[model samples]
Target: MHEKIFEGFCISSFILNKKLKVALTYNLKPEEENSFEYAMVSPLSKNSTTYNDTFAEWDTIETVNSIKSALELFHNVIMIEANEDAYEKFKKERPDIVFNFAECAYGISREGQIPAMLDMLRIPYTGSDPLTMMTCLDKARTKEILSYYGVPTAKFITAENLADIENHNLEYPLFIKPVGEGSGKGIFNNSFIQNKTELQQRLQQCLQTYNQPCIIEEYLPGREFTVAILGNDSETEVLPIIEINFSQLPSGILPVYSFEAKWIYDTRQNPLDIFTCPANIESSLQEKIKGIALKTYKILRCKDWSRIDIRLDSKGEPNIIEVNPLPGVLPDPSDNSCFPKAARAAGLSYEEMINKVLIAAAKRHKLI
Candidate 1:
């Protein structure tokens, strides 16, 4: 028995040490791109509120390099830009596994573009599958799934046109944002609509600007928290919870973590004291948040890792704001990225965090 157990352990160690080829697929932001160019090209170029958040969801070269560096520590790393040629690249190289976080720029199915290709090629990748990726990107579809599972989520309606907003009977002070965006794209202080006229105007603006359906959700009034989760079923680990302190935001700005708040105001030179890790909450509340976050992760079929945004309702119950299967990892402490921040709070270095995600995926693929 002892010899058999020892043999099994040795084989496991051998498999773990066999370095695999890792394709670091990403959508890199154009180095020279600026807000002026975005605004000039925007449909609402005449509107001053138009800011250059076009590449907001894409990763910087620094971020892609950082992830590549981390993976190189243990495996052979290959960089693949997620674009029209990405499918051919994957077909040619066919790495052992893909560390995919390609937020492709285009249609409602943008986020799932790379994943769908990988699926067709029968290649494994990190995070959720194509269906889950597309669903989570479409906030309305995500909310619908959550609601169907009896998960707590804010009441919301998708407005493709002004008539959709006009037909809604939901109460006022609602939050409006592009249904298929992440990294705070298309979200701003004015996203908070107080009355019918403002809602109609904002809805029209979003439709014309974003050229996509907008989800108008009944705004939750209590404190907000974002939970980062890692691993998979039965062994999934919830990292330290991070609370978004609205009080720390620039005064007079709405409490929402809009594009301006995330990218403009909170810079490395002058960072906003906005996040509180391991949020000062009762143990019961922590468990509640973790429970809901894990349930949401599983229900959405999120694999490897994900970050779920939760806010408290008037009754203080936690309601999921949105789900991020491909959570951002900026790799800089001062950048104030929530996933890395939460992982740091849980005592994980950025490199460790990245490797853990890869390991999870490799294990899932039975590659390790």
Candidate 2:
């Protein structure tokens, strides 16, 4: 199985003798949302620490160190936070390229802020551009685009408030999620709305806590899988497919891969046996999954690489859950970062995953 999965896996796109100066931009957990409200209130805010929480979404110091060390092997690396001081710091130490992992401080365009900044400076970075980031951040908007392209995704409605959900008789057993948050933030067991009362309560809570509307979509009752695509649009490779098992969750917990399931239950010390690399499936189904992921990646015009979440629907067809252009790359083996896990599944080490991305960006920027 490993032999089949790693058939054509290239560890790195470029083996450069010249060391490029790369600015590694990221938002660390403690430094996230460094603002006046954050000063007065706790960094997690008055709302549920899990919902709309920037801290959880922010990368850890270990992650920054891991990426920096990995890139240093192939380039000159400098770390910078995507905070207020980021502009000045970046301007002073203007690197040739930026390996951006910043998730912004606030606003609907938050995920795209760092990318937009780099664009203004005419500096190249890895991952999708501002428009792609913003579009992908809004779950509803992404689904709309996928739907337009005839890409199968769960039918969903975006609600700015409870009133937005009042008019129509939407489907039940819907998946509720913050319209613009990522990394499983604002997702919990109760996110699966089975009835009106559940929808009303969860939607209201979502609005109040996340300060954003919730997307109520048809729930996918089949298996969950995350596929990582690496390389440019014309030469992208889909890494080994990953099947996530929710059977490890304690009794009564929804089978969905919610925030608690990701951050709380799946710890490094005793990682849950919740994943099957090179997912056990027939050859035809595997090809179908890869095709769907590649199609979604191209439609979004994703640059360099992306990890797309795909799930099976009631009729046994693959559908896109969402695309993560800047998917999490936590270095720790215990941390359940889907991208890294998939990379390892395909025989690429953590360093290989990090360097492959930098090399892809460099080649795209015509640097090497």
Candidate 3:
């Protein structure tokens, strides 16, 4: 079944045009001996305490190589580390297009750096543009945009210090995370705060550790789902919705899918039964989830693909949790990455999923 899917995808690619010169640009997580170097040098890593999870958002060599191999099936592929030398490399190689998933090393706008360079070079790239990338990286900014556009999102505020969190009208039991970090960085079981004291303590610790503003929002007390979106404009397709089974988590932990839940408790060795693809919800609720996900994708101007997380409010209506412009695509199914899991539920193999993104970008750029 997977073989036939890949064969059909390749035939379609040939019909569109010959194989493309595709550059797979990403930040490969450093080796163990050098991992601390990223923590020490990162401008965002301000506290003296060593943070081993500094590179949590960056891709591993296995992930990078897997993406490269997938792209290689339908295009000429090159590996380009999105680093200080990325601009020079892009200028020299000038691939026909870029498959970018670089969670850059420093700065609040780090995620936009590679896309910005690609924009300046007038090179086509997969995923959202620089403005959208930077905006979505800042949780507060993304929520603000969604709220203004009449999209349902949690009530939230940004705090750079404890004082910034004080005297807020928001109720207790709020959730918090670094404003600019993703891949569950700085998020943990303790991120769910119950009262003023916990809020203040967590805010101070997060500010010191992340050296960035923290977004504290009212905690939604209902089920959570993630929607994977593909294509553009009127033709956008929302793939199967995946519900997060917090019940699968260990006893005595918060229901939030924190860094521990994502990278610690859940692993390839002993994968948790934590996800339900094609979530067994009534048709009406499913449509509501899909509608909001698609609206959020368009409002953010996400180009080729994205994964939008949603959770039900107290009223049982879907509200946006967060938008992931460059969604993770860990190839191994055992790893349980959301985007690929959703794709497989929609009858697309891993290779088909990767090429579908490339095809969407190529069609958008009129390069096919």
Give the best candidate by lDDT. 3
Question: Candidate 2, residues 283-351: lDDT per residue as tens digits?
Answer: 999999999999999999898888999899999899999888889998877777889999998788888
Q: Please, what are the lDDT tens digits per residue for candidate 1 over residues 1-368?
A: 32243342234324666778889899887754463223312433456656767778888777889999877867798989998999999999999899997998889888889999999999989888989999999999999999999999989899888877667878878999999999889998899989999999988988887899899999999889999999987769999999998887777788878887887778777898999998999998899999999999999999999999999999999999999999999988998999999988988878778888987887788887
lDDT of each: 0.86, 0.82, 0.87
User: In the order shown, what is each candidate's alpha-carbon RMSD?
Assistant: 4.6, 4.7, 3.5
Ranking by lDDT: 3, 1, 2
Which order, best to worst by TM-score?
3, 1, 2
Q: How accurate is candidate 2 locally (lDDT)?
A: 0.82
The parts of candidate 1 lying over 4 Å away from their true place are 1-14, 33-47
Off by over 4 Å in 3: 1-3, 33-51
How many clashes would you count in candidate 3?
A: 0
Q: Higher TM-score: candidate 2 or 3?
A: 3
The clash count for each model shown is 0, 0, 0
Give the 10-residue window scoring lowest on summed lDDT in candidate 1.
35-44
Candidate 3 residue 233 C-alpha distance from true site, Å: 1.8
